[model samples]
Target: MWSWVLHRITGVAIFFFLLVHILDTALVRVSPEAYNAVIGTYQTPIMGLGEVALVGAIVFHAFNGLRIILIDFWSKGTKYQKVMFYVVIALWVITMLGFTPRHLINVFSH
Candidate 1:
């Protein structure tokens, strides 16, 4: 249902983020000055917020992925799939709440 959709979406988002990360890291070997210029844009407040979204996506994707594994490997897992979905959501919310404020403070304070 919704979890399936979200898992796919988050997985795609994470994949793209990793692709960009690899590309950016590779840029340093190609041209240090160009790489530095590219990374400088990430210092902006907008990129700071993007980092928050990236973290959120990674957290949700990781938790939901474990839930999927449980459903696949644990015999009783299917019986509790709905509950596990809720648990994943609860964990995601708690994690984001703990992370967002501290990160925002650091991002804005800079």
Candidate 2:
């Protein structure tokens, strides 16, 4: 269902983020100035939005991974997978609420 699709999407999203993160981090060793320039670009409002998306992808991926683990290891998890997806959603909302305000302020108040 939708959870399966989203789980895959988030997994891919996280993988790409990590790939970019590794490459960008490697720039630090090659040229400090280049790394600083790249880091400066990340401070923009557009990249701030990307940061939010990154956070969401990470949160969803973590919760969905937990769900998959339960489904694999727990006898009754498959029976309640939908309920667990809802639980993951609720947690995501709560986690986003806690983060969005602070991140927005940091993104915009500068």
Candidate 3:
């Protein structure tokens, strides 16, 4: 139940993020200085936290989607849904562990 709610929330977040990212990146073609300024704002500590959250949302959404796929395709996946959810969570944690250190280093390097 929590997974379902989280999956939906992350999906919406990623969707909106994609829209904003595209628009922001498009500013590069319009004006270099504008783009640089926007990019500079992303370097802030809060934005760094947002970046971590964005990564989390992406990873969780992806793994959960794969879990859904497995539940649809595998013959016994329904019976093992709990296990699959745990696998998704474990993978998500591992992915975050791998990403967080480097991201934090870069974030605080300023």
Tell me each candidate's RMSD, in Å, in order. 0.7, 0.7, 0.9
lDDT of 2 by residue, 14-101 (tens): 8999999999999999999999999999999999999999999899889888998999999999999989999999999999999988
lDDT of 3 by residue, 1-110 (tens): 98899999999999999999999999999999999999889989999999999999999999999999989999998999999999999999999999999999999998
10 residues in a row with least lDDT, candidate 2: 56-65
TM-score list, all predictions:
0.97, 0.97, 0.95
- As for candidate 3, its clashing pairs are none
Model-by-model lDDT, in order?
A: 0.95, 0.94, 0.96
Best prediction by lDDT:
3
In model 2, what is the error at residue 66, expressed in angstroms? 0.4
lDDT of 1: 0.95
Query: How do these models rank on lDDT, best leading?
Result: 3, 1, 2
Candidate 2 is scored at a TM of 0.97
Score residue 35 of candidate 2 by CA lDDT.
100
Candidate 1 root-mean-square deviation in Å: 0.7
